[model samples]
Target: MQCTDHTVSLDTWKNIQSLGIQCKRTTYRGVRAGWRKQVKKHTNASPPGNVSLNPPSPSVNLGVINAQSVGSKSAILVDSILDHKFDLVAITETWLKPDDSTADFTPDGYTFTHIPRVSKRGGGHVTEPTHYLGRMLDLVISREGESILAHTKVKERFSDHFVLACKLNMNRPPTLKKIITTRHLKAINITDFCSDFCSSAFSTNLSEITDMSHLVDQYNKSLTDIFNMHAPAKTRTVIIRPFSPWYNDEIREAKHKRRQLEKKWRRSKLEIDRQLYSEQRHFVIGLMCNAKINFYSALINESANDQKQMFKTFDKLLHRSKDSPLPKSSSDEALANRFSDYFIKKIKTIRDLFPPTVTSTCIDVSTNICLDHFTLTTEDEVRKIIMNSPSKSCSLDPVPTWIVKEGIDIFLPALTHLINTSLQSGSVPAVLKEAHVRPLLKKSGLDQDDLKNYRPVSNLPWISKLIERVVSARISDFQERNQLQECYQSAYKKRHSVETALLRVQSDILSALNSGDICALIF
Candidate 1:
């Protein structure tokens, strides 16, 4: 049969089969690194190592590309991908309408591919579709030490949308396969391989494009178009889910229920299907969260070198966001502070699971000394505490600033205590002036003028300056109450300490009395 862009002669069909076998072998038992690394050793030349390389042995990474229709947003999304060096990027709704005036795709340094959409016929003039009738998908891939080898289109089911796929030539041919159907196998005089993959029952929970037939038709049509053209001898077809709605609420809930049932049947048939295996064809299962970065290794497995690297990578990815709304009160300020707290927690969790080796120079920031001064008792203790802190779940935004504001109240005391104990800088004024403090004020919806009435200490000259802004009248009363409460708390703590000390002194006096007074009375 003729395939897309080329005739699938017997030789071609054999080639596809061989490629598929090679892929299975490579994925299951290939060398630790990649095909290029072996080539490099043979060539006797080595370049700087790319840290992003997933040392071979069945690991897949998943990332999302939020490229907006506008060129500016697309550039930002592309930059983010390049910076992170993600393994796979599931791009969403790329409004790429190809026409004479526009290029079909743009790959940059990456090899690009897309599934072109076939225009659907309208029933009448009134039924005509606007803009474009067909859906297309674009996939771009780049491999270290490889030229942009394969950039082309294949018709594939991505979701409801078409999927475009690109794979850098890792010295392996792309293999597209079709499951032999019962009818087809009978007609072709074949048997064993026709075992029903659909009724496997083991595959029921797995998500796929709801309409598999439509996807297959798209693939066949694209194959025809590709075969009609004279292109590379190696080009083959693949079926990639156009997109996955795993993040959708309904799907997630359903999966959660399934997971619960699976847990109950752990010792039975479910265990076999649920066990982590390289054979799982799903991208997330097959690649992204692999053995190298398993859940167990991420949490407790921390060595100094690995911990350092994990933090470094995390810090780089934590790019500064645009300015948030200004907070008007201390409550608002606390909410702003929660953003970093939450982000840092996420970093810690991921790092705990997969402790990547990190390095640091002696001349790095001198902030380690400050960790002890905060509410954090010790720099080391702060790791798990801040990482698992409750503030991690709060979202910082102007519209729902209250959520962040509320979380800050819960987190700030813990954070403040940690900072106070570990990194004791008497410069409370300076600390409050930092970016973290500013965001809190903006979110609190309280004005500086409102804070003036709460001054418990007139001696601190900076207190007056903070109260000058009249943004929120409510803050004045709240701050006043807070000051009074703090004063009472301070007094109560001092009183308790003094009473305890006095009691100890009195006990010592009683001991002395026992040693002397009885002898005197007897005398």
Candidate 2:
């Protein structure tokens, strides 16, 4: 017996049947396949009309196609797969080069591998009428005994080939879930919050508090209570998705409107509704593009003068969002304790490096002036300092600095008394010295899990900052009056900064140049 063009004569077919052999033919367009197999007959089998040879099981849907040159049609291909709910897919004649990345063609939920023609161009194998001309060049093959429930030929064309969809016996894995915590600060009413704060026991006896440490504890507890009462924390389960930092209210509203229009079009099945929905979709896309551009432009402009900030902006624009995850530990408390131990050990080591005792040599005093004590601060002085200070606050603050500034009249009398009592005692309150310390990464590209790569950032309470300002002002006044500060010292001095230092150096250099004197500079 001989086969020609996937066909055989009638006599040859009969001879094969008599020999207990089965033959089947599959054809699509000009493509043809002929199969020959040896059949095993069982005598105890059930009736053909009532029984089945194989039982069905849970399955995974798969698809195959020939994308001649899947350049810009990646989105279209992904959409089709999603619509058909294919769990896995294979492609032929992807026409991707070695330089082309598989990630560029792969969708979010799927991954792909590409074996391109390396030696020469257009040498890769192509498949399923995968050709403009009806031809089954692409194939979807399964292993022996592997059940395929359906083999469908999709009419939609992705390239030259038609989509071949198959359902096999496998199960798809379930998606992962993530949980996050969120605070609803927007739900709080500023007016009601202020009223509640004023009525709270925070200022029941402002001048009666003789101990500064007790006053600070009361301040922290009262503020935290008020904040929690207004905006309680909540936990929620959420799916992790790609974050768009530029997404804002306008774009969100536009997207919502577009979805409404899309639902209307789908329900009505009207051409006008479809057109309206399409317009809204385009509008939403434009809005997003504009918002992204504006957001990035503002970032660039704001960081133009700061080199470090500019590089950070560039990293965001290039999608280099590398956030190091927290290191593994037994528990959050354990991690905190580890960090505390590390920092404490480091500080102790540095302190130990200095000599325990120093030889002292007496020198003749050049000036008789001295600053023995800080003058008492009045309510007016305290109010001025608080008003001039930046509206920055930390979690440790009883209330935000801005809130204190807004109601300065209500808080000034007590705050002034607290400052005067501490000044008279010549000792800072223990509570004021306390700070909330956060571990911040030293710089980019460092090993975040290492304790040495982190630095402690201490955030002091608002009231502590106010007292510091008052003390700084008094010290500055004393230094200026006595001329105790070095004339050349340009740091931490009023009207003196890096720019002023640079100006002084430049002027000296010019003077030396004019006088024909050599000027040596060291950095």
Candidate 3:
């Protein structure tokens, strides 16, 4: 035997050798007309007397056939293989070319390696009738005589070609199988939780604690205790399967119906049953396609205003996996310490760039622009701020933002006093300053295990954010009155954004063109 055009892979060669076949590389002469006769002579020859046809041991069943063309006959081929319980299969005369993929013809739980006759259109030998026709054009050969048992011709015809099933006295080698913790927030009753919070000492005795640190600590502890009582955390081992964003209940039911119909068709083998199964299969396919379309359309519509969310939606659609896990060499504590050291060193390096002290003398200005102290917050102002803020919370928060908003009226007085106390003392409580810092990947397509590829995202306590908002509002008001803010700065200003900045640039360019002045922009 000679192989010319395509080379068999080392793994495939090893598999062939394991079956007791000896292969050697040889130059291929052009196909001769007598090559078929020569192959037939060799295939029909008897094995040596020393070789045993059947060994008293467990063995593997293998099948071979001439597919002629496997493209449209893959389904039939798969069914025949399953019915025969063939451990492996070798196909011939597949009529495949270099450009064709074997994956399209390969069955599930099986893989294929093809060495197409690339040099010519068709050139193979013939055998005894294993086909509907009187002659068999397909051949199955084994190097070791004992490896090829008597070929039993299958009664079923696969695309006008018959299968040669054989049992080999060779043993097949044996092949070698995230817990998440989440709180049951859905089980919590908002009404009962609010009533319980209102009755708690943290609410009623807020005025008794004058110390800011003690007040903050008690606030955290009380809210956590109440929240945990209502919705406790649970841990379970969950199977991580491929995420199908569009797979919902409706599609699941359709798929279940399709499977039932398929089973019925296979069992009954009736025309009506087959037709019903086919129709159901098509229906399920259509349902899945429509569901996927609707899912993406809705996602696009909802994320129209949010570019970050829009990008995330694109990632979902593209089926991009999350960042790789952190390196396993370091323990959790060690990783945290390393991150802290890196950030600290980075801060110190930046600080080192500046002088230790400034020698410039202070100059007094005559303008009456001053923001020495922040005014104490009123209950109304505090309520407005809480209501207007986005309902987002950090894990560090004693309660979720939605829960706080839900019980705002009950929480108003104490929250109002806390804000006023902070403003009066011109200091934030230590507990409120604490944040849950999570290291997030800076962007996609980066080495996630590297510390440099991540940035720390700090989620501060809700009350701390509220106080910061109050201070920001006061500073903004002072800036507006004194015109201390830069005129060209569009970010972090009300009703101002990247769009506004772009519009300003466009207007300036247009004005420059109208005035016959050349405008050069620099990044």
Candidate 4:
């Protein structure tokens, strides 16, 4: 939330530019030696008006971003987009790896097609030396789980360049069309109309009723005669009174006592929650301090060579100070000052780089799918960094809705797992270990060894403490350990209530009891 040095952005941008590799926009006429192309041709003809064959409007409304790039590099771009919450992203100029025989589907909840690009075998201008296949662009889509309705690449105005288009069968709402025709109505006579003939024609008829009162009457008389024949000479009637108010009072008191007992039992189960919030605060502070120190040390180590050069410069200046024919101009002093500022600035820049803002923004690809973009920076990492974080911003552009729907179902779970792993282990995920984290660091031109050495201390002291506690308890047979763990769990629940509804309800009672807020109500 606070920053002492904010100007390190200049250096940060410089590192990013120097180290990060930018993907090229390539369009090939035919297949290259190492790439493969899977064709997704469109079946629908061009529609009337300027309606795009691959409509992007629907996808755009779902927060899909329209993008275009070349080849499997485009797929990598999708990975980046998936990392962020983009509803949809489109790529152009795709050059699928020629030798790749596997399906063109992106593993992360995204589906795509590699338009087969074929070429001539000869060494002429159109064809590459080894590959005889042609080149084709693909439509990468994430439409939840829906299939693409159409994907086509059409050449523009006889040009060698092709325009790739894809339409997803995302089962959108339907439109209506109206039809008009003539029909004849039956003719009516004036006299029939005057008699209300039309109303009579449609009236309900009650002419089929049958009588049943005679049978009922005869049965009732026969029953009365039978009863009279079996009647005794004398009959007696008895009445019983209800209990007194005192008896009722006792019953109510007993019920009230039972309610009180239930309430007491509920209260007994409500235990104390003991989570060291103050300790966690200290832990966070220690972790930050350790991280800052490590970062400073690494920076100092990097600039050691620079400092040595400065000393040499100082020595040279002193030697020249005595024999200078004309005194060194004030310009020289200014220049020297400038150089010092620059190097010291470098130190601060490196220090600024230590903290990064960490945030996850979910980009809705469709109604059912979303892309969670995880961003990591020192200062912003601890907070809930939403899409509108000050350091970063996003917009919902037009992407094929199909891509939004299909993309997350394929990609989100894997990404979610990666996020959970990163949170739990405080380490980068293995699957994308090299691709995502290493490449970014490398792109920044940072020293790998220094970065590795400067790794942030893990914030999970409780975990280590717990392990020790468990082992010690096991050796000593300490039942109190179980009690402690239970207390810890209770405290954890109080501190971290489940975000989900059902989970919150189930844990609410226990959480209230643990926090010692359980109130008994008896009536």
Candidate 5:
């Protein structure tokens, strides 16, 4: 990848500080244009210990720097590498010239990877395996759908170093399970699909079936087929670029020219070439700084009028990472067994929280069965629940909330009957019982290795949540109608909070103290 601009100064630091962003110690503003902070590994080791001894970071923040002969900016680059804590940095044109030793450029946590380009320019051809004017397809042993991409740039902007980029999926190995994609959900012909599904599946007996589970299965499969046919999922590369409105083609050309001149100066032993390179370098630096000042000034003006836009601008500067590598046991068999054990233990804990069977409940200070005045869960209630729910993706389910809500008109009777049947039979389907556990990092700046740092998020299907919502509504209605709630109870009740509870306690304490009942208050 070609770099953006190799420009940094006190003004750049002030710009970042004004935005409340902390500057990394050895700023690699030139390492890669607009350097993003590296994701440091979680380690208990204090200062003075070798960083390389620490466990490897989940990712490598690579920066390619061209020192134009290492002596000039060697210290600055070393400090930047240490401060940003880059895992792997590829440096080029160090002007090592095959005679120089590699003592000075090495930093604490890092070791250099590539061989510097040697100049035998006076003698015809270069001996580099891969050069700008060369091509070789570096293929990896990958699965059928997997891809390996190699991109080249005509100009080396950041430094004259050759960019080595390889981005893997980082997802777990592929399974035999049929994957479904819904990339084009909005374009699906829902009305037509529903019309066909109803005709083919339910035309025989219509709504006469007592058991609706079979119908629900047919409904699910039909919808799945429609999705598979219309918007099937495929393996595709997703590149997310930062929002940089000010970076234009003019600056791109200037950076490219400056890099060419730097390379030319490095290769030549002549004084005139060196002078030309120095002059061009200074001109590019001034152009870059001016461009940045104008961009930020415009950004600040626009941001003053819009808070959301300003927050977005702030988020872009931070470039927060959320990649957490999956933890695995030794073997495939071991992993499978561990997962089985975990889910088994988790289910046991969950089951322990509830009674063995569902039973009717009564209001009014009593906790006994009340079959006489039990209300039947209605079809309208289910429809209303689906309608009001927000559209979002669940963990494992292929079906989304919007799809469920959109198809409610066609699937209402089936869903309503299914829910009622589940309630009446004192059981829910096995699908609802199953859940996916995702471990999310508690903070962006925490050790990812320790299990304690992650919070397990239980993701059951949205339909399961909808069922729970319905049940919760009934329980709430019963409590509200019977007036069984306490006045001072500020929990599990709407418009009540810990703040209100604290205020009540504070008032009682103050009343006692004001009335000269300090002893009573203390007691």
Candidate 6:
């Protein structure tokens, strides 16, 4: 409990339990002498020292041991760790080298960072002038009473000097092992490695392949192999229905009892059993309500660190989306097919307004646009266009834009040739037309039950986008040269605007008036 101005009287303290309040009596300490939201009358700032709400611990036991050679006396070091259990241990004169393997000497759950001797460097010093007193960064923010306990001692030792060991019981790291399953293509960022590998892979593997399909297949496979070798895929856990705070033994039992009672009621033809079942159902509902109340109340009274947990719980309660199960399908493939069929139908319906007959109207061609008269796309242009494409998920080709961009320089020659071939052929590749679609919820409520409430977002490959851009540029150039489109159309044409149209109309109207001729409609 916190009181701003008034002191807590005897009655106030006694009735505190009824008010459902928790408190810590310690006064907050800050640089401004004491904690103040806004200091009205300024006072001198307090010196930075041990002026804190949390008292410093005097039981910290940190020690150091220099055993001269750790490889010979590793057993002794383990015994020392077990006996003393020191908070921190620092040892000097570790005679370890860069090429030395430490795989066998790794601790069970502890992490270690080491500094190798200075004799192995080819370049005088890579980063800093100082010696290798190796360290990590300010990754995690330390809270009150928080500390890191490092157990650096390993059984299979190799150094002459004893390894530095640190231990802390209060602030141990998390032990939960999270499994992650990913292709690792998205995670790895080795542009040089990718470029070199791709350059060699595509050149050697794709040199003799005559079939275009076979060439692309081998090229993709080689790239995939190189990537897999460098940065392998990961097997991770994906949580579908994660654990909930409100669900517990009491709630579980209550739910089970309700289910049992429901079954009994359905089975019995007598009115007495039905009446008893109704009573049980009401009792179970009350039990669930109480459990929920207790759960939220406990969360509300928790420390500030658990605010996120509380918010997640609140969100879970608000939505209750997990309770509503999806419709049953034969398999995952069946479900995908079902959704594809439904959305395709919807799309066809939407597109039916303009029939084939309407679309086949004759196009006026006063000036001939020579079908083969096209400028060959340059290497730089192709590179720029591909790079300009957004880094999105891969399509049927499974070629990510980022990966393509990373090794763009190496693959530019091949890409330029491909684009040239496409232009000369006057046909886009079938792969470019292929797309992957994902269905997303449009919005919540009012129309949630209908198929129309969902929208499909189609993701196309970078190759498709590149082709479209090329074709669009040529079309626009042709349109401008032939004056095919109306000059008054300000929407798509270059250097045209609403103001330009208005000015042209004004000029026509003034000319009509001066010539004593009627302008029926100036526009």
Identify the leading candidate in terms of TM-score: 3
lDDT (C-alpha) at residue 225 in model 2: 88
Q: Tens-digit lDDT track for model 5 on 1-523?
A: 3333333554564466579853333333333321111111111112222223222324344444444456554434454454344444545455565555454456532344445444541111121112322242121222333322111112222233323322222332222243343376677677875675566555435456555466445545665676666667665554332123455677668767867875654343234444556567657656655665687677777898778778776654343234554445576576445555665677799899998888878555555644333255787888888887767667555456676677778767766766666566655667776777666767766765445565666788776787688777777677787776687799988789999988988899898888988534342
Expressed as tens digits, the lDDT of each residue in 1-523 for candidate 3 is: 5633445555564476579763433424432323333434434444543224343357677777777777656444554566576777777667766777555345444657766665865323433226544355655554654534433334334445556666566675443106787898888898999898889998888889887778888888888999889998788877543234556798768767866865554344344444566677667656756776798999999999989889998876654545545644457899888878887788899999999898888676688667789888888898899898889888888888898888788788878888778888888977787887777778877886788887887888888999899999998988987887889999889889999999999999999999999999999
TM-score of each: 0.18, 0.61, 0.65, 0.16, 0.49, 0.42
RMSD of each: 32.1, 13.6, 14.6, 42.6, 16.7, 29.4
lDDT for each residue of candidate 6 in 1-523, tens digit (9 for 90 to 100): 4533334544554476368672423433452332111111111122222123232344333334444434443333433443344443343333445665332222223233556557742111111011111122101112334333212112111122212332223443333565665775546766755565656756655445545445445555666676667668678776332233444677567656755754543343234334455566556546645665687777666734667666766654453342222235678688667778889898798899766665656877675556565677899888777776666656455455677777788777766765666676666646666778776666545354455566777877666677678777788888777767776688766688888888888899899999999778831
- The alpha-carbon root-mean-square deviation between model 6 and the true structure, to one decimal in Å, is 29.4
Better of 2 and 5 by TM-score: 2
**Sorted by lDDT, highest first, which candidate order results?**
3, 2, 5, 6, 1, 4
Candidate with best lDDT: 3
Q: Compose the digit string of candidate 4's lDDT tens values, residues 437-479.
A: 1112222334533322222211221112222332343433333
Residue 102's lDDT in candidate 2? 59
**Which of the two, 2 or 3, has more TM-score?**
3
Q: After superposition, how far is residue 434 of candidate 6 from its true place, in Å?
A: 2.0
User: After superposing candidate 3, which stretches have Cα over 4 Å from the reference?
Assistant: 1-177, 301-311, 321-325, 359-364, 446-450
**Which of 2 and 6 is ahead in lDDT?**
2
Name the regions of candidate 2 deviating beyond 4 angstroms. Answer: 1-183, 235-240, 248-285, 297-326, 361-366
lDDT score for candidate 1 against the true structure: 0.33
Q: Name every residue pair that clashes in candidate 5.
A: 3-158, 26-80
lDDT of 1 by residue, 241-336 (tens): 222211234433543454454333322222222332112223322222232234324433443456755665444233322343432536755644
| lDDT score, candidate 4, position 14 | 42
Candidate 5: lDDT of 380? 86
**lDDT (C-alpha) at residue 460 in model 5:** 83
